[model samples]
Target: MADLVIADVTVNKKASVYFDGKCISHGVTFPDGTKKSVGVILPASLTFNTGAPEIMEIVDGACKVRLKGTEEWVAYAAGSEFKVPGDSSFDIEVSETVHYVCHFG
Candidate 1:
């Protein structure tokens, strides 16, 4: 996919580190106060719990994900997206660096 350009957004300098630093993201806020993050995941497997419903858009590379309540892991590539319910968790396995934009709602 082409680069994601969200106009009039604020990008914070602080990095959101997770999985003992395996996953990292930065804070981004929209004009209306909605929150989001753009980050890159290293080659690793991680489980993430969401506080809000998240729409994860893959910006680069690929990964396999198994969402909550699901037994199968699906492959996602660049230009694809997945959703995770709030207060739930999911598993992601990445073989390469994967860039993503996460929209919180």
Candidate 2:
């Protein structure tokens, strides 16, 4: 079994954290004191925490990012930077390996 841990993204540093079945790209703090990061979904992964959203830059393959209230999900290519708000909920569908730099604050 994996241990449970908590983190504060308000400081400054890169943290590659490993959870139960997923690896998360954590450590982000905004000017308004908000924290966020990207959770790397392992094969056969599903999450219930529709985590606080922010902005994501696709650093790799195809990524399907859907907004909380939008009818259509957007496809982001490499180097694509977009905002989806922290309070807004969403999901991800990755056909291939997708990498994102999660910025929250």
Candidate 3:
């Protein structure tokens, strides 16, 4: 797990809401130019497309994710993480309200 406290980052006040408000996130930028999004996904099934590779760190709650071109749905809970390739997509079913940090690269 990464640090719980993220310091020296600029957080965008405006949120990026998706899936008709089922998912909401705020972009954050580090001092070194790294970018991430801190967000919450309400209980729902959603598909997300990635323009960049992403490592999604689960902060709280649980979800099952199936990556693009895959059939198996992997379960992830608090303290767990999953990676999605760039230019691909993933289907996520959130059983609980999921709090996560999406690291982009």
Alpha-carbon local distance difference test for all models: 0.91, 0.58, 0.95
**Decreasing TM-score order of the candidates:** 3, 1, 2
The predictions' CA RMSDs to the true structure, in order, are: 1.2, 8.6, 1.0
- Alpha-carbon lDDT of model 2: 0.58
Worst 10 residues of 3 by lDDT: 1-10
Lowest summed lDDT across 10 adjacent residues in model 1 is found at 1-10
Error of 2 at 42 (Å): 5.0
For 1-105, candidate 2 gives per-residue lDDT tens digits of: 211223544645666755464545756576667665554544322222334555766666676666667778777766786676655566666666666666654
lDDT of 1: 0.91
TM-score-superior candidate, 2 or 3: 3
Shift of residue 35 alpha carbon in model 3, Å: 0.8
- Tens digit of per-residue lDDT, candidate 3, span 15-68: 999989999999999998999999999999999999999999999999999999
Better by lDDT, candidate 2 or 1: 1
> Pick by TM-score: which candidate is best?
3
Which order, best to worst by lDDT?
A: 3, 1, 2
Instruction: Tell me the spans in candidate 1 whose CA falls farther than 4 Å from its real position.
Output: 1-3
Please provide, for model 1 over 36-99, each residue's C-alpha lDDT reduced to its tens digit, 9 standing for 90 to 100. 8999999899899999999999999889999989999999999999999999999999987899
